[model samples]
Target: MKTDDPTMLAAHDWDFPVPIAYGPGRLAEMGRRCIELGIRNPLIVTDRGSRDLPFIGQLQSLLENEGLSATIFSDISPNPVDSEIGLGRKAFRAGGHDAVIAIGGGSAMDGGKAICLTANNDHDLWAFEFEQPVPVIGQGENFPALITIPTTAGTGAETESTAMVTHADKGMKFCVWHPDLKPALALLDPELTVGLPRTLTAWTGADALVHAIEAYLVPGFNPLCDGLALEGLALIAKWLPVAVDEPQNLTARGGMLVGSSLAGIAFLKGLGMVHAISHMVGAEFNTQHGLTNAILLPVVLRFNLPGQEEKVRRMAQAMDLSDTSVEGFIAAVETMLDQTEIPKSLGEIGVPADCAARIADKALKDSAARTNPRVATQAEVQAMIEKAIAHAR
Candidate 1:
């Protein structure tokens, strides 16, 4: 299980956080890991959809057999807002839960993480917004121990310290971050992902690609992230199609899980415009985060291509494309999108033309936008949105 890449090893040093349990059939280890971590009373936070699955009941039974009593909180929505986080926090405190077991997709993991953070903090959740002009002020040390078991292979929520939640009032997504919020453990069981539908497979798989591409392109000095991003991109390029077409293919599923995690780790260095726009659009429209990002990625790439020629060339190499130019890269991505049956434009995915102005305004203020290689203005973002919407039909 050792990687020869020094950068990958460096990225996993003790300082990086998240002890991962990866591979097929690793879901059975969750109860043991919880016990080893001394979590006697655990809150299982997930979406309502996941709660209905047979695996959810099986996991709870496993925990009870291991002497860990668990409570379930599955009222959260696909785009978790502050109200949901507030409810989750209340459940955490009222149930006397000592730790969090976040299981399912991105929304469940993020809602659980937010609940864990706010359960101990006295201030409002937005007080810790990562996009603010000044750095978030907090005690930064105390939180319920967290374990994430991802049933899907997107968002990389299992390993990252940042959580995205929509503001109930503003209808905008904001990231709350603290080093203590990083999960104590991440269990990736590909067997759990075998039931994913083709559309979800395409969306989540494309979302992972956006993370890797943005992380690699963002101007930074972190070689560890660069190496991991390149590797992640390569893996996704090779395996995502196979995974989408053949859901039961363990090798493809496993590769996607690992690639998604690597992409998440790489984004610790930060993301770029695709995430910025995707967050805004998703919060307002309640669209799927990964699908929104997938639709916007090609245009965002075109917008950022002016100064990123050299990096795109390297990315082309990683993607194993014969053409190493930016145009070639964009074409390859479009081809991938077509192959995956992804919607061609924002309009196709229900993002309206009228939201263009609002999305642009929010995108400019997003933390991810600040790290974009090429500075993007509201006008430019609006133009991109228009193009994205028009191109869909």
Candidate 2:
């Protein structure tokens, strides 16, 4: 896993944050990892939608059979809020849980991380916002060990040190970053994603594609991240459609899992306008993260194309598009979107026209937007939002 790229060497110190075990059925070893982490009692955090699923139930049973007591907390929502984190902390303390096993998609994993970071800290979770980076966890002592199991092929939340949490009153998204928030281990079991619906598979996979594309085009591209971004983009291009068309395709699923993880790693270097805008829309409209990302992908690409033409051309080459033009790559992305049945516009997702200006204003301030190749103004962001809405129509 050594890379010799100078940019990567300069941008990052080549640190792999967590121990990752990736395979088709690695989830079966969760009990052993929990024991190795010295957890006799573990709280399993997941979303309500995934609590009763076969995978969660099976993991719970496996842990119980191994003589580990487990408590399940499934009250988290799609965009986890501070209240949910508080509730999870309460549950953890009540159950006397020693460690956490986050066993679902991004929300569950993030919620679990939030609980772990704040379990010993007395301040509210919002105090750890990414903007100020103060009141940092792991400031004085070690945090609890966490194990993550992602049931989706997107969001890469399991690998990163930050969790995107929604502010309850502000109705906006903020990040909680702490070194301790990084999982002690990530068990990527592609088998857990096989039963996902086609729409979800397409949406999440498209989100991964955006992550790679954005990372590749971000202003501070480093060789290490660029290589990962390029490979991730290629993998998604080759495998996402297959996974969408055939959910049971194990090979396709595996490719997607790897692509998603690579995308996560790449974004650690930087994300861009697509995530910035998508987060605003998602928080405001309660839209699906991946689907919103899919709808906004081409528009953001087009908007950034003026400044990112060279990068887009490079991405086109990686995607095997013969034309090597920004428009060529954009067209290729459009074709992929069409093939996956991803919506072409924001209107399709119930994002109202009137809200466009507000979303733009917020997106202009998003942390991800700052890394975009072309730093956009509020007016420009509004225009792009309008374009996305019209395209969706």
RMSD of each: 3.9, 5.2
User: Candidate 2 has which clashing residue pairs, if any?
Assistant: 8-223, 345-392
Cα lDDT tens digits for candidate 1, 122-239: 7688876785543344564368898888888888778875789999788889998675466888888888888988999999999999999999998969999999899999988988
Q: Show the lowest summed lDDT stretch of 10 residues, model 1.
A: 2-11
**TM match of model 2 to true structure:** 0.93
Q: Which stretch of 10 consecutive residues in model 2 shows the poorest summed lDDT?
A: 5-14
Candidate 1 structure, TM-score to reference = 0.93
Can you tell me which runs of candidate 1 are displaced by over 4 Å?
A: 1-16, 132-141
Write down the TM-score of every candidate: 0.93, 0.93
lDDT of each: 0.85, 0.83
The true-versus-predicted C-alpha distance at residue 241 of model 2, in Å, is 0.3
| Model 2, span 1-393: residue lDDT tens | 111222211212123656888776677787787888888998899998898899988999889988999989999988788889999999988887788888888889789888887876676787777786567444544567788888998887787668888887887888787754677888877889999999999998998999999888887639999998999898788888888988987778877887888888898877888899888888888888899999998888887887666787778877878987877788899999999999878998899989888998888778898888887888889988999998832
Q: State the lDDT at 272 in candidate 1.
A: 94
